[model samples]
Target: MAVEHNEAVVLRAIKDLVIEPIPVPDLKDNEVLLQMGSVGICGSDIMYWQRGGNSRFRLEAPMIIGHEGSGTVVKVGSKVKTLKIGDRVAIEPGTPCRRCHQCKQGAYNLCPDITFCATPPDHGNICRYYKHAEDFCFKLPDHVTLDEGALMEPLSVAIYACRRGEVTLGSKLLICGAGPVGMLYMMAGKVAGASQVLITDIDDNRLEMAKSCGANHTINVNGRDKLEVASEIEALMGGQPEVTIECSSVDYSYDLAINATRQGGCLVAVGRPSGRTLLPLDVALRKQVDIKGIFRYVNCYPAALEMLSTGKINVKSLITHHFTFNETLRAFETAISRDAKAVKVIIHCDQ
Candidate 1:
């Protein structure tokens, strides 16, 4: 019966989370059951816990609340061939309808009928044992810990943003927001052969972290206005940036990204702000900037895993705090606190 009961971190409502026992779902022919090892607390997870949604998604029902997870395979369904019991893997939360047009076009991330974990009506993998399609679980290499495996979700975001921005050999770039996603962008840009990458944020600690992760220049826009920061970023880059990635949803960041980018450059927006935001559309139009939007990622898990396995991207330093599965509430609190010193908080579920 795949054990008996599965313990999960469930969010019944705003500011309400309880560890409850749920049934371990029966495995499908192509599914594998996982015993969660680690789950990273993302900004969306915090929003879901605090106010029941992150903007576009509103929670209407109690749900298991986690999407970034890694686990050890406890069992495999009869038809599962790629993985077996005892395999370590990272979970890809989104399962798109394979028959959809977007899926066939290799843009499955855009599938309208995707079932994403923890996104209301959809149960997540934060429990002791959870079943998932074997194809969605990527095996982790020996050196990559489960924590790093969990991080593949956000790393995929950075990879997608960098790809959309066309960061290539000797490209000059500017990234706004030194949070987890911003830091990952800095590393991804470097990996894409960007010669100069400058990043800006309102936090000094995050800027330092950005530098450590390969940002050529770090700007702390704490007390400065957006125009001043934009000028400063241009000065740091020695010229206008060829690509600008806005990872922070701050009001002024959109303006900075639009104005800071060079003529004919690209601006990719990855962060989702809560409400309507105004942008400097005139400036972008005059510059002929290619403004793009990134929603999650498509076909990026394998690339992210390869980077981790090759030691090209080190997400270990980003993990600043760790909590036991029992302390899931505390972990969420730490992540929601926006403590600049805390880059990433991980919940170790192996206990």
Candidate 2:
């Protein structure tokens, strides 16, 4: 049966979110129609809902707002060869124009013509029914739940950040922020053979969660001086971190990352700092630290899935709350509420 109507969570304007009817998407030749199973509320989604935009993208018009999601294929397009009806899949959100130079160079995430879900003009997959390009969807294994499948988006991000930072065996890692992304970075770094992982956050609750997830050291940076925090991080790790992943978008976190990293090490910026973020450029330059930035991820879905399937990376604990599709507003509330201590909120869209 052809689906004709869809109900989606739409952000009409700043601080405005509503569940409304949307037109059912028509599948393209290489696309598949999905009955969305699970959708995770991300930090970006919160930004759009609260501020109407992030640093790079703005909500110019009403748009459905979810990028981290997984679904079961209800129908497959004629040219779709790898997937079929009833296949459960994790969506990789961003699809780049294949003819672009970036795409040709295997860095499709950098393609300027890419269409990323819930970013500006791109509508997302937080609906009862959604259609996506076949290549952007990765099939979920039998053991993987839809909730875990949805989490693949953020997991891929952590994997990519670790790759950029060159996390290797016995590498001392300092990750600033114990948010979902920060916690995932710690896990990914550990899997990539980092001997010791130190993660910092202002929230005690979040830091506690990080500790339960195998973080070697967790620090509460609330009201602490940046340099002092940096020194403490190095002391806790027994040496300066070879790779520092700054996952907190605060200026203090950036300063801590730069000051704490070892000389000639890598500093990968995973957080999107608002406006102009002033950092200790002299420290970074004098230390000859390699600073890099990642936009989403490139070719990391398979690795993320493999980690999940092999039990090498367990993200099940990261999921703190669940809600039905109709209770999306409440889910978002829980995600942004400081008292909720929510790490990952999953919306069961199948209902």
Worst 10 residues of 2 by lDDT: 1-10
lDDT of 2 by residue, 118-147 (tens): 998999888999999999999998999899
Per-candidate Cα lDDT values, in order, are 0.89, 0.93
Give candidate 2 misplaced runs (Cα > 4 Å): none
The CA lDDT at 132 in model 2 is: 94
lDDT tens per residue, model 1, 168-192 = 9999989989889888898888999
TM-scores vs. true structure, each candidate: 0.97, 0.98
What shift in Å separates residue 81 of candidate 2 from its native position after superposition? 0.6
Report clashes for each candidate as comma-separated counts.
0, 0
